[model samples]
Target: MKRFATLMLAFALVLGAISGAQAATIKAKGQWAFDFSWLDSGDFTSQDDDGNSDDDFSASQRFRTQVDVIASEALKGVVFFEVGTTVWGRTDGALGTDGKSVEVRRSYIDWIVPNTDVKVRMGLQGLSLPGAVAPSSMVFDDDVAGLTVSYAINDNVGVTALWARPVDASGNEGSDNNTYDEVDMFALVVPVTLDGFKITPYGAYASVGKDANFTGVTNGGAEFLSGMLSMTEFANGAIDSSSSTYDAWWGGAAFEMTYFAPFSLKMDAVYGSKTADDDAESAERSGWIVAALAEYKLDMVTPGILAWYGSGEDDDLDNGSERMPSVSPTGWGVTSFGYPGSVYRQDTYFGLNGAGTWAVGLQLADISFMENLSHVFRLVYMKGTNDADVIKNNAGVRDAFTPGNTYVFLTDEDSAIEVNFDTTYKIYENLSLVVEMGWIKLDMDEDTWADQDFSDAKKLVFNFVYDF
Candidate 1:
């Protein structure tokens, strides 16, 4: 903690000196949050960690700040720093508080062409694929080193192009001889707006070297891709060791309609496919997913319905998975227990992806019956689309479907229901307090899971936040 403070002071002094010597303007924004939480049956299992149950109770805090140095309207440099999801009494939050926990979340620059309307962003930055019906996304969404070029053709039309390198193992051991140990991606998006309707269509492509280091990826992507690469049940090895590369592609469109006052509708549909060089029949996977949301705004609240469906694995493993592949999924769910997009400063268990499942939900948001206070309530039910035999008939795949992972692999006979209630109170212009309650009832067919049993999950959270 002391080191962090000293570093911050030195950084501020350097910035102040630079500002004094230049005409650039300096601006800053940040957030500080603390949370207290209680959770039970989070993993839906009875496993204990060194005699302690999987359930948890704890307090944690986080801090983030972004600074921008602007030379003019056309050029600027930005840097964002983050510290901790540090739990009380843990490493960085312990009595001495001497842990090294600072991270550079983003460092980028924005510039525009001198005589054209073209804009460019370069460096480490946050990026997301276009999607409707949620603040997060089911496809790629995270901070990555990349370059983006955008042009506004007119008020109603625009286009953007991007290129990113998610993994590069150029100098690593065993990588010197192989130039194919990297992953590169490219994408394009076109957005159109007319009247009260809007839509965005996008397409993305990636080249994955056979020896690509998935560890360099973030947001649960590493695990998902690693799982796909290691499935050995298929004939002659799912993804042959001799395969040189894999090609992956995705196409999607997001639509929004607000032509009718107080009523709004949003939808997204996407398809993705990945194929390995070797013709191992099961070396390829392809599928699709669609999601929609509808809401009606009233004087007291906004009532909404949300739904989604995604292709899942079929009965035959030899044909590979029918489920859609995602690089980094951050889908928002209606209920906190199922998706937890609405919760603040609280760690959640459910994987944000809606892949391999179908769900329906209803929510009442912005329910305010008292001054300075508001509430939101949601209920959702979900069922898996994958065949039960995918796991029941293959014992080798069971270890990969454990509860320790970020996302759960469910079969056709698996279902779950989730409920969430959230309350918020504005204590000051820049500070607020929030409380969240959530529960989930998970059911897995006994016939398919055999001796495996899962318990219900519940959680309660309280948070204090300040923004500047």
Candidate 2:
């Protein structure tokens, strides 16, 4: 009798498992990209270990896949994984090809409130503030573990709020770990739409603990934060570091007008500030940025003019930096080689945001003479807005300010011109081949670089992409 009862229980459990599996649907999609590229940085001083020059040509590939389990339109869970960029002939992708490169890029769940219009997304996910620009946001654009909630009040208005913890040093067990060793941010955005126009205004605030370990943060968080702190009292004078925290805030608005078909205009403006909790005069930094683009779409091509300017550093380091502070800017400009133009597998400048500069460009995009083939041409002139006195008067600031990607850091007398001609041809509905060529002529001030010869930067790339 006891054996009979055990068998019956096992059968019931199997039926329940089958019922649950039938209630949810599974879906999957992903992309694969392979690249053959050559890049000449034009910096003669660059060398690898053993005092050897690094190679400029390489082949690499990346793959990403996302799986979704959905019960309904408003309820689903997603898990995204990536085998990140792996260079050919490297240990990871060589003959053995046994590299442990697989990473969980994102994991999240989306659900709506019962009988309500409010929706919530919770987990490690991508977060980007609204911007009129095509590629990315300047202030904050990255993936972090966070909770986001959104609601649509009507057809013309909506709101979104988010809370994210980008860094949490409390997980470590050491002197650097403390109760306040973490960074948290809160933000809200209100979007309004009317006919052919739309605008989104946003505000965000962050609390940075004094002992927070920025080195663990990705996308150049440590570099930018340390650079800004160098201009403040904490780095130059005696201050009670244990009792102080940093407060950072940003406000911005993005606008777009497309009421007139075939012609459109877009603009983005933002201001940012950071200060110590004690409000030290030497610990305050603030700046602003404005950018605009106007484009007219023709039958064969779309011509556009883009321009942007950002406040740069003044001569007084003791008064703090005048240049704007950013979280993680993607640095998408007219060309991929000069700036971190929006491209797959080529976003090499992981954390260097292009602040303290100005630029103007003319773009001819979507230039296609044949089906399934397209081309883009861009010419950009860029210069720095920072006063040269900051580097001239300060000692060691020049070398310390140089990040991994040294192409975009310019001074008042420094300038560069970039040109890009890229082409793409679709082989199938989900496969394409692309070739990109780029060049930049640098004009560095002799007095600043101390007679060092700066060569022109060049790039040639071939990419094969497949998506589903």
- Going through the candidates in order, what is the number of backbone clashes in each? 0, 0
Query: What would the per-residue lDDT of candidate 2 be over residues 1-468, giving only the tens digit for each residue?
Result: 999999999999999999998899999999999999987764523454336776899999999999999999989999999996899999799998998889887899999999999999999888877788655677777778899999999999999999988777667556644656777889999999999999999998888776664655555454446334535432343222644578889999999999996999999888988777775656667788888889999999999998888888888876777877666654444356665673564443212344678888998999999999999999988888888777667655655443342334578988878888989999999999988898778777777755555566777899999998
| lDDT against true structure, model 1 | 0.78
Q: lDDT per model, in order?
A: 0.78, 0.76
Supply candidate 1's per-residue lDDT for 464.
Answer: 90
The TM-scores, one per candidate, come to 0.90, 0.91
Please report, as a residue range, the 10-residue window in candidate 2 with the lowest summed lDDT. Answer: 231-240
Error of 2 at 249 (Å): 0.7
- What are the runs in model 2 whose C-alpha is more than 4 Å off? 1-11, 42-54, 172-177, 217-243, 280-283, 331-334, 348-354, 403-407
